[model samples]
Target: MPNGEERPISYASRSLTKAEVNYAQIEKEALGIVFGVRKFHQYLYERRFTLMTDHKPLVKIFGPKTNLPAMAAVRIHRWSVELCAYQYDIQYKRSEDHGNADMLSRLPDGQEQETEEEKVCFSYINDMPVSAADIAKETKKDQTLSKVLQFTLNGWPSHTEDTRLKPYFQRKEEITVDAGVLQWGIRVIIPATFRKQLLNELHENHLGINKTKAIARSYVYWPNLDDDIEAMIKD
Candidate 1:
């Protein structure tokens, strides 16, 4: 204790996927954590890892079963089934106690890599009755909903106007019918990285057809476009 404050001896942490993504470190961490699990479990066919963590929900989930009816039970049950091949003992500690594991959690982003081994192990099915394709199909159907829309690396186009092109389509801030006559709308590139904002626009109903159209044009015309987004827009 620097000032005689008690410091924990165990460690606990969770890794964030969308934060500072450093490719090299991501590669290393990917190997150690994500891939390591796949490979480690592959050969052992049976083992229990002591996971140190301070995340309350994760602790309850990974810890032993309890009689209490909890939502976390669903999550834990799923984890238990998936990790059944290898035993996992979930234990708790102060965040300070779990320094080493926390370091793995803090290991600058991108250290987690996309590995072939993991892809194989984490593949669509094991004992589960459903295939990922089923869920994906549902998602695709949802996107195709007339009110809802779908956009991806491939798709979108053939519904845009010619005289006024909609080069892009993306989720955005919600729309709010303006006080004056400026009826709002939305326009975004099909494959939008700024999905949160785009979704907001839809929920709020702030942006309208015209604005959505303009945003589309801007996205299509952006420099990164490989082919003319305008051409694709009107497709």
Candidate 2:
């Protein structure tokens, strides 16, 4: 069977989440590659193989030797990091020529259930002072963050006249929503109502400005977050 003919060993598919459904086309394409690789990691791991994608840009972005741009979409960069664990060559195939995968894509089983990994990440949130629901509800109540949530789910505009929304717009590519909570990369985006409370908790130990900022940066984000922490410590 080494005569350049292809054979299918297995198949897998699932519907996208509401958050994933709104991802930019490139992000969705990158997700597909990551999903396929992860779904079949048992077979794919420790072996060399060729990854075929209908998306031409992925061939370059996911190429083994490619250097990802520093400003590339955060999700894409994260996926690229996951891909680095595998040994494979990515190649571009025209959609018309990619019949096997195309047919499977047209027949998704159902909405994806939370993976074990996600359950673990969400479980970590339960141990925090704030819950996901609290963040989500307050995000809706906060006008500026509410707008940022909408932009993250839908698409960000090229420009915004509101200065308050400008910082979020500039980092739009790094923003995402999960379980109703807005996030910048892995950090939760705190709403205005929660910021003061979180600031108090962060400062509780008197870890001082630098240590508090480091801890806060690990778990939360808001515009001028560092400045806010600095001012709180100074006052």
Candidate 3:
């Protein structure tokens, strides 16, 4: 930043190769650091700038005086060594706070030809309206769902399979409740059948896919939720 204002010097994005796409999450993250530095080494080689990443594990593995992790894969070892050439510090930022990379990763193929206005911009909303409050109340009214909701609001036991909460047993491990709101990690956990209705409520604002997804990220959880949103918008 020159004169205390942030300025963009250079940026790059690319599709992951088939091999890269198949890597485990950790390896993919490691490769990203490697690739980013290699791409910008000329500019970065002589200067020191902190490296920021949402992947906390990368920070642990690369920190000073840290020994090579015993169970680390061979690929990780090589990447860790490569990072040693740089003068930098590793800092952690939450994934939700790191949207650009996440958005870039979600880009559909053939997006290169799309104009800047076409990217990160949305034209319209195609979702039906639904009441989020009514749905939440009704879902909470169910005896089975209530227990899960309470557990989320209060706290869940470390151990699972409580017979009283049997209905949640199948996916109990995926459940999370924060600030009186139930979530499946970052995804909000709601009744399976009501997902589309909830998505519609979240999407009805015509807020663009990423913005809608961001709204959903704060309150809902489901498998393939992002993909479902994209399909819902298109359909």
Candidate 4:
């Protein structure tokens, strides 16, 4: 009965990683398309179907005949590569007209599963100066960070009087929790108890202030992170 009646077969959803949460709006839209295609790969791999999205620009970027620009973002290139394996056509529907997908996205089913991105985020734990478990446990013990973690997961309040949480509150949007450890845009938020030890490790090789700060900037974050590095060097 191919009478042009729309039907739903399956649904899937997952949360974004700390880094992904910071992607540009267009990038996020592109990611959603990739996520859906991948989630239903078994059903859609060899079959032809219409991929509908409210993000109009995607029509051009993902259309069957459009050539991806050489200056497009790396992520766009990667996602396009993934779509190359499948046979489908991309179309744009106005947001108001795409109520079903929009509503489902707004009220996604409640189920938590580790995504590949999170797995990659956790892969480097063994190489870190502090283990993920240590960070998680210490985070729970540190009153400020523990509170920050709770706020990040549950949702932050409009205002807070605690001076300790002020800095975190100011940047609440950037904070995220992964397996209990808090992170700020991919940088691990080191707990107070472990900062001293981590500082020692950073300074162990006498990498100097600039080098030390550069290394710390890449892997970890905390209040006054730069100041702490400077103080450790002076002391």
Candidate 5:
């Protein structure tokens, strides 16, 4: 209450609801839009939240992209005009951090997380595709997957039987055990004994860093194996 003799009440005392506090609203369908990034930008608009994402296709249709993927270009061009109404900020965050946000976005249309209705302008910036050739390069010392890839490039090696080992193979050739085998034009063919050993290596070698490398190496050294490591990497 205010009296003639008392100072008028200030807006600082007023409380804000979800809708009242937000002016901009945004969403990223894929894991590309991360939480820390989302939250940080949300803090910027003060009364609004603008969405940003990595799924170039979706981002272009939803927000602004300066120099981004093609899908991003189309959307941002359209969104820029809509964004003239308010000031918004865009930022990036890693995928793992956005786990919660990604999960919430996938809910069926009727079940979207309850958020105050916000004016959204879908747009994106566009640019050339990333040059994977440099980063995805293969080297001789790559070993395992790399070696297996080189072996394939050189063509499949001949297999011969020896009594020393029932199959004379170091690893098993299970279809399911390998990733993207069909794409590489190679399928592992080996005895059950080889399978058991490979399985043991997979289970026993618990270190997370080189699991792919070891499995790939086993494939390279094993019997009747075919597939390019580069293809596997792409797949």
Candidate 6:
């Protein structure tokens, strides 16, 4: 169509899987466009094209520099990276002007069925079910972890040779607290997000409860951590 011919090049449409259906409208739209490019990479890769969508926020996101808001999840960040493989201009089109895409979006498809093996491989239960708010609250109660959380969120103080939190200071840049959730690199701080999952990993391997407690102590700390690990293993 770059040559001005009315003829089309490629077309594709498919119902999103269950996980995708739960995405916000902006995420869904961005995914659809990204999927389209991937599906037609032979035609789209290295070639300039215009990706029209009804979501205006997508325009800003795909721009050269993006100040992703706090509400933007890591999922959005991943999707943005996936979109970088192509050269395209994201333009907003009115819903009325968006024709076939609107109809395809409404086309119903059956839910995806997952096998038993899939279930075993993917347990949705999070190990640490703690929220950012809970992390903040807990930090206020514990002087040590609170200092660690604050140091991770804000900048750590200079000169900490005598401090017990020397290890944290050494790796301060890699550790961060975003949206009240402390993260050590990509792995969330186990205090709240993946506590249960980590415990299960230890228990499933029959790593003795004491060993698990030792492992937790080396990297992280919270009140009753040993008790929590023991309970998870018992379950």
Model 6 bad stretches (over 4 Å):
1-8, 99-125, 129-235
The residue-by-residue lDDT of candidate 6 on 1-235, one tens digit each, is 5885444444566776654543434556677777777778898889898888776767887764666554344556766788777788878889786554444445544444533532332122233444445655655565555677666544467658746567556655345444444444334444444456556666766778888877666544434578998888777
Which 10-residue window in model 6 sums to the lowest lDDT?
Answer: 117-126
If both were scored by lDDT, which would come out higher, candidate 3 or candidate 4? 4
Ranking by lDDT: 2, 4, 3, 6, 1, 5
Measured by TM-score, the strongest candidate is: 2
Q: TM-scores of the models, in the given order? A: 0.28, 0.68, 0.42, 0.57, 0.22, 0.45
The residue ranges of model 2 lying beyond 4 angstroms of the native Cα positions read 1-13, 17-27, 36-78, 85-105, 110-112
Return the lDDT, model 2, position 129: 89
The global C-alpha lDDT for each of the candidates, from Candidate 1 onward, is: 0.34, 0.80, 0.60, 0.77, 0.32, 0.59
Give the clashing pairs for model 4: none
- lDDT leader: 2
Clashes of 1: 52
In candidate 3, which residue pairs clash? 187-220, 187-221, 188-220, 188-221
Candidate 1 — which residues are off by over 4 angstroms?
A: 1-36, 42-44, 64-77, 99-105, 108-235
> By the lDDT metric, which is better: model 4 or model 6?
4
| Root mean square deviation (Cα) for candidate 3 | 17.2
User: Clashes in model 2: which pairs?
Assistant: none
Steric clash count of candidate 4 = 0
